[model samples]
Target: MKKLFFLSVLLFGIFSFSQTLSSTLNKTTLALGEPAVLKINIENLQGKDVKSAPKNELLPFHLEETKDEIIKKQNNYTREIEFAVFEEGKFQIPALDFKIGENTYKTIPYEIEVINTAKKGDKISDIMNNKEVKLGLKDYWQLYKFYVLGAIALIALFIIIYYFIRYSKREKNTPKVISNKTLKDLELLKKKKYIENGNYRLFYVELLEITRNFISTQYRIPANVLLTDDLIDFMKQNNTISQENEKVVEDIFLRGDLVKFAKTFPDKETMGADFNDIKDFVKRSSKDIEFENIRSDV
Candidate 1:
């Protein structure tokens, strides 16, 4: 009776101790040069700090420590380590040793299979001599030379006729230059009573978009998508807009942003001043258009 009781107590202690440390592999199979994870979970650490295992070069694996997390409720500590296998074979990860409060414990070893992705004993030379194929127009050219020439000539004639028709239609339908379009759009926008109707937001939005579109068309700077500062930077970098004219454009954009985003209302005088400034900017920037207008009038 006394021996039976002692054996039961001893077995229980061993079982509890065995449950304290455990290790697992995320995947047992891997391809060469691919990484796998090794998880070491230690329970009932009792607030003792633990140190990771030292890397061993003799093993068939390369080990790297990735993460260590602590679970306060369960008194558990988890260490995540990464392992990469370079050689293709079946191997076992050696037991990883951990130290806690002058006591050393080791995790169970895990077996893994590393597969080779490359073909064995295969070389470019092995395939180079196995097959030979000849391809060219020379072999069939003599038999169908006249037919081929006729087809090519027809294709050439069709292309010439197609381009001639396209050119004639384009000449008849080509719209006026961008400057003329911008001027007409501005004139139409000015006819709207957006400011008088308390639609300052709409007024500024249209104003800014029109100016940005003009800049995009004239300078090709994509000003429509760029903010005021970015537009200024682009212009400065390219030296496209003169410094004085750049300040005028910046002022207009700033006021427009305030009206559009901040809901600020500007007086009629201010609106009129900005409107004239835009017109002046367009005229000065598009000298070629102004010259053409002058020539047409003369």
Candidate 2:
């Protein structure tokens, strides 16, 4: 097992009959999270095997080992490493240590520049200087949308739930909306595949509407026009749902409102989970499934 060492800080390697190792970087400058390539090649391996590329993880940037290539005829070894820097600054991808069999090897350090700013220049500009840009509705909305939308959503939700509760108490004698119809609504929503298509806003809109409509018909509530808070209040007053189930239903509606008005994004899993939650709620909370079955039989 022979050892190799490089005292030279120069970027290039010295070639020899025994073994020559060299490293090079494909890029030195990149935007934050941009990736750079480091290539290492070894020649005259004399039949000993370096199974894989070695990487230094203690460095400032994230590093990953890419595919390695070995040529038996030429007795050469080559590997390309891909690394990305999230931090903005000049960085040195420190020399990586490699232990192949009993021989140890090191790759020379490489320089890199990671820029955080969106501009083409390297430096981050100073804090925003006040400039009189004409403010438009869009500008104002962008500045305060989270707060304003949140307030509106909260208010709308309250109105909806209040009406739902008021009417729900009056509909105790009303026939339960059939389970099949509610199930069809769920099926229709699934067929729309809004989440799959990345139309989250419309997806939530339809889902909330469906859930609310189901509640409106099932419990004699005007849920079609209500929000999460209204439904919560209605449930609490009516004792229509157990605390655990009420929590699930409330969370579903709240999440729907967030996606609809708060510009919240729900992932596929979240969307699917919420949909299933609504479906389960409708199945369990609907009051007259047995009567519906008997009526259908008749």
lDDT leader: 1
The parts of candidate 2 lying over 4 Å away from their true place are 1-177, 286-298
Model 2 Cα shift for residue 258 (angstroms): 1.0
lDDT of 1 at 226: 93
Instruction: Give me the displacement of residue 198 in model 2, in angstroms.
Output: 2.0
Model 2 per-residue lDDT tens digits across residues 1-298: 1222344422234443357678888899988877777777877777766644334443443543333333443477777666677777787777776555577888899888888757576686679877987999999999999999999999999999999998887565343434557779889989988878888888888887877777676666677665578778987786655566678878888887888786688899898888888777767764444444556699
For residue 264, give model 1's deviation from the true position in Å: 3.4
Per-residue CA lDDT of model 1 for 1-298, tens digit only, reads: 9999999999998776643888778889989878787777888766777766444332343543333343433367776666587777887888777787678888888788889887987754564556676757886887799999999999999999999999977665332356667788888888898755666778888989999998887766789899888987888886667666688888989889888776578887788788888877776775544444566699
Off by over 4 Å in 1: 1-176, 288-298
lDDT of 1 at 234: 87
lDDT accuracy of residue 213 in candidate 1: 92
**Backbone-clash count (model 2):** 2
Query: For candidate 2, which ten residues in a row score worst on lDDT?
Result: 1-10
